[model samples]
Target: MSRVESAVGVAFAAEAPVLIVGAGAAGLCAALAAIEAGAEVVMLERDPVPRGSTALSAGLVPAAGTRFQAALGVADSPGLFAADIQRKAGGEADPATVDAVAAGAGPAVEWLADAYGLPFSVVDDFDYPGHSARRMHGLPSRSGAELVDRLRDAAERAGAALLTQATVTTLFAEPDGTVRGVEAERPDGGVERIGCRALVLACNGYGGAPDLVRRHIPEMEGALYFGHPGNRGDAALWGEALGAERRFMSGYQGHGSVAHPHGILISWAVIMEGGFQVDAKGERFSDETRGYSEQAAMVLKRAGGVAFDVFDERIAAVARQFEDFKQAEAAGAILSADRLEDLAALAKLPAGRLARTCSEVERLKASGGTDAFGRTFSAGQKLVAPFKAVRVTGALFHTQGGLAVDGSARVLRPDGTSLPNLFAAGGAAAGVSGSTAAGYLSGNGLLTAVVLGRLAGLAAARLV
Candidate 1:
């Protein structure tokens, strides 16, 4: 397909106006937005495959008051979205940044659909934990790899050039702290300094760096790191060296139920439909109703870093409706049983205690009362005779902290002054959640990637 015309309908000059580092979702979205604003753009990716953590995600972006939600007869607003966030984070997030994300969320999702023809639909089955409404937009295939590919296609069609295998080492700047460009080294050990009027750091977080992980979040220091390998604290190191203000550096997102041995992620729909986590002793330690990210530490310390996600055949049937679940099942990531006792045997646990534990879970679900660990059951679904289960463990998926930015995603100094011509977005920027795992709402990752990226692009375009 031919490249789509620029949104401004103005051809870019010989020299581009914007240079973006890290050609993941943030860089690609920023490139598209800058091109639409009548600026030529160049994106650099260290990986030859041009992939990052975005490719490993489930591709859920929560957008309030979107056209899709309206079509479904749902009423929502940015105010309500902000309110929801504040409530989830206990009012610990930066008010300005939260408001900016809330306002741009619905438009960002629609823009992806209207401009790039991305196939997005609202997830309507059930709301995730901590979210009060159904506002997540995802692809038909429900794959984040597809989302990254779509963004790359859109950026290319908009005339933004993406270069792969270009490792950005550091930022070049004037004495006044104005970013001139970046110095990138080629795979062959050749270095080139690429200059631009504006530079954006979309390089993501430091998930792959063990030292940084321990420094910022000591709680998850020794846990399994499951994020993309390219994230090695480039953004944080560069930002700190440049004297950028760091906010909420302790926050991170954790996955409590990773399908191990087979390497595919088991969808949380199993838990959403009355599933529960049990140890080998067939005892429940913590509430499984908390969102995956918030429950990671609990699962790790309480369940000995290992547990089994036990669900019924009916819940499996509903979960298997999704492509990921189907693929996981086809890959032998799940075990099936005709009877609860058989499932217990497959899980290598005593059938008697497991039966009693499941009975208690069912009672809690029906009663709607809080459990000992403070988990309240919402869905009335229960585990019946036919059983399905997956052995799972906790892992750190993404860091929820990075360079702090202003309303327009401009990197700021410690005193709240914007750094000249320096911007950040996506995992490169501070997340919207509070300073811990307990505050992560569903779809916060992509919301920051898309909304902040668009804002940064437009703001940078006007400058250069």
Candidate 2:
């Protein structure tokens, strides 16, 4: 809880080897890695606690070739995972960064579970979009809050100094872009200047900044901002001022199934499990299975900025595994009926159109044919009786673009050279996703968080 105080106007001398801004998954993991490497580390958090964008996520980190996957008889490898990412991103991602994350994800997950004692297990029940294997690892409760909490506890236990309510606003660096330290402002208008041998920016992205979002991803300007409010593009701004390169400025992760009025997130499992989304007019618009991130724009435009997610009892059972879905059910965001017309009545949709849509879906399932929107219905995954529905809206979860970095997460210059003693991870760095929302593979955010975080921590410690 102590901020190394300095003589007024004189910057504090280097108090630690590595100074990390932001205490989310990326910063916490970076601290753990630096501490493990025998470097004194200090993690500064703007908020009173460590929960950031990681807490708002589903707590799933997809990693190929993990022991949990092997134990479940699932075959996978980093090569396969990297290929999937490239395919999803349309080959727009940096090859080295993609390969590094895919290769490091498994080891990072295993390390967290084995060393930190986090109860992580493979999510074998269902598949997220763009992931070819059952590689998502999560805690027992499948909640991001639990993931952040456990990581925080582990980091503190491992001797990393976790300081809260320290909002870093300025960087103290040499004229040549060699960062020496930062200036963090407290709520009481007190300034704390902390110096370090190396610096890591894990403060996340700019989804919370309206101006930045409008400048980069103009399409999602009106959608609900579901990410942490503290993500104000601090890293990008700081990097730009320091002459660090930035890439994929338009990439982001958006969700299509946030339950409206109640503000609860309904898992996309409902759609992936053969359920469908309908507009207010009670008609299927786009291919719901294409990917949930892309589905956000479709839901907003095709569904008049709002829609209803229609699924059956079986899909609901699959969705019940998520805490957010359970919370949605408790909030009355989920409606149920045994028949399509009854369901339509509860949702106040056109009953005739709803019935016809259901019949068309059934026909497509029986014939195994593609619909007008080009979505092929699989006969094996059919929606049965006891239908459930949730009124939903689109939401911008987080930004995926920021300061460009090398495989080791060293902040790079515009000419592809590394900045001295500066690193970035998680949302603070450009992600593997390409320049659009469609390129986001499932769990790519956390993938970079743990993988690049550890890499940055180790690399920074070596520099120290």
Candidate 3:
């Protein structure tokens, strides 16, 4: 039950077939695949099973141009998906890398639905901003926790042993520079060594570590991190210790949420659907129609990624229209106010300036002025008098940058050479979205995790 007992040092008579660091989506998938391939696998997790960011995710998986989409009469191709990624990444992503992900995405999604029983549902005409096709998928349960539960079951049924609350302290390497295993510290202050012929790092990103952010990204100079507390850059540290190539440490995805007194991240998916984001003076800023990632980036760059959600009694009345609004309010994600002055005061904005800005917004609504994106407002009439304000801060949803890996999910060194006996996948592997302007591609993250994990598992099984 305790981390120390779970990870108490016991050397394997010989190296196990595969040792996966982190029992998140990537690690669980890799362990299950390796075990299914008749290889012995051990998975170490810093947190308990069925917990962590993977469980906390929204679990949107997008595999564009697949046979499923084609069956649904949706027109798409891996090439088009790759091209979109390349364009969004500003030509920073390697073409081969993007192609590899797109190529395996279809199979990976199918495997999740069929092999693991992920309860996926096909959604026609579901639009992901900036993408040409409607290729987004979601769970019928509509909760990431449900998907993670299924993954945990699959991994266990496949004979993968999961050790929770076990933090890998260092990767053990042979003299020839091949990773052999890992050393970990258990929650009970015990040291444990797990030896294996191959090591896979799926430990995710360092978005929660302010020190790492300050060192790698100057833009986040004073920005508060809004990711999982356990994401302290341990994976990045271990990779760096082995001279692994790193990328996109400076870039991170931002979330629009209410930062409560205790720093809890309430989902912005609510505000986006119900209310509008405004600046300190209560004026609309940035394109509201932009993708969540793009909006987060803009807010981070311009307004420090913090704003107030301004909504009137009508908008509040219609709050039940969005599931996120109800959940956020239930979870105390939204701050409330009755009058504009009191709302401004609670949101720490100048009352007079906020009132003036709101008045201007009302006039613009009446006259149909241009919106934040220069688009003529059609919903201006919805802005009735007596508005409410909720203070929202920027939160990080997931990390974009990670270890440099090849198409096969092999971790490459700085010189583009493969790390011996070492592979990476999931958020721990890099070169996915940092180069693309369109942030996330729906199921891109989870799909990549499953695909790269299977590849790593199969490849590790072949290693001597």
Candidate 4:
């Protein structure tokens, strides 16, 4: 399956001790770690910039036992974090890999903050569905674009050369499945054959690939893909050609609350903070708090492919911290009114049914009783005057499944043996979310990116 000769007299255009494909969070973090470990690094990016799915995310990374967590007097441990991952994943995830990522995540966050000067702080407010503690850490903006920009600047400052608009189209590997180099095509249709002692596949997963989504995740085949267009499953294809193991091809991160028409993501914090969703018929459907990822199919199947997220001014204030929410508000996606009927009229929803839904929600909160959907409305603060609503639709963010790797982030064969000098991270590797979207806990994507990227970089640097 090799497209180029592995050991023949091929003209080499460039070389590096460590070569990484794709310049997303994984590639940038790997470059940082490799440079810190005294190895020369080169990164190839298909786009003009380093933003991938990372830019589309909220930029939150969950960790255990970090200084940020301790500073807030929140007690957490890696063991507890691993347990939470397993429980959320239905015990289908690999125990060893879960343990390794849980252990490395905190240290990776600290390293990025202390060594690279990325301002990191744990979110102390609402907790994501499955996390036991408020361990989500992010930059001040709480936006993935900020995180990617900071990481890119840090990598460049550390002397890691980043080549943008360089698309790696083919791999040069030996018959024994040992990768030796790659052929990258330039925008002008020129090709460059680059050699490397070690290679890292950080190109991300296949959410943008309609054919792959139809073949694997058929449930979300025609859904809106909100991930990076450059995530066309190049890493998964290369891994297959190199005889590397692949797993959990159906797993993905699906969101139910992307502001439709505006294309801005309404933060799930709204729902976590006493907001509820109403379908076109103005009826509450499903337990929204089960997980945002699983809410995608629910919104699609039961909500006539669109729904309205209803919240109050208090919840809106909490959601205002997210950059996406502010963007949504600025784009006029957020409809507001002092009265519920007027707010429903503004969103073109059924006034009477919407009122009934709110009344039911209030009843649940007042009585502290579980609704028919198994979701309990805690007797917390009630939603007061000035209501808010947004039109939302489900979207596929990215795939969580790809090439399978070991604890060190080395690509593995079907028999569980490592591929020589080949590693995968981020969306390019099977994630800890098991084999479905329901198993996804918040921040799982960034966790794998930082933790496995750091491990892959350190291990690859050792080989050089």
For model 2, residues 225-304, the per-residue Cα lDDT tens digits are: 99999999999988988889999999999989999978888989898878899999999999988788888889888888
Runs off by more than 4 Å, candidate 3: 1-14, 66-73, 122-126, 258-275, 310-325, 332-390, 435-444
> Better model by lDDT, 1 or 4?
4
Residue-wise C-alpha lDDT for candidate 1, range 185-254, written one tens digit per residue: 7889986666778888898788888888999988898988878988887887778777888888888888
lDDT digits (tens) for residues 350-434 of candidate 4: 8999999999999999988889999988788578889999999998998999999899999999999998899999999999999
- Clashing pairs for model 2 are none
TM-score, candidate number 3 = 0.81
**How high is the lDDT of residue 143 in model 3?**
54
Residue-level error in angstroms, candidate 2, position 155: 0.3
- Report the lDDT tens digits of candidate 3 across residue range 356-431: 7667656656676776575444344455556565666655566677888888788888899988888888778874
Each prediction's number of clashing residue pairs: 0, 0, 8, 0
Superposition error at 278 for model 4 (Å) = 0.7
Residue runs of model 4 more than 4 Å from their true location after superposition? 1-7
**Between which residue pairs do clashes occur in model 3?**
61-443, 62-443, 88-436, 88-437, 89-435, 89-436, 89-437, 255-395
Q: What TM-score does each of the candidates earn? A: 0.95, 0.97, 0.81, 0.98
List all candidate RMSDs to the true structure: 5.5, 2.7, 5.0, 1.3
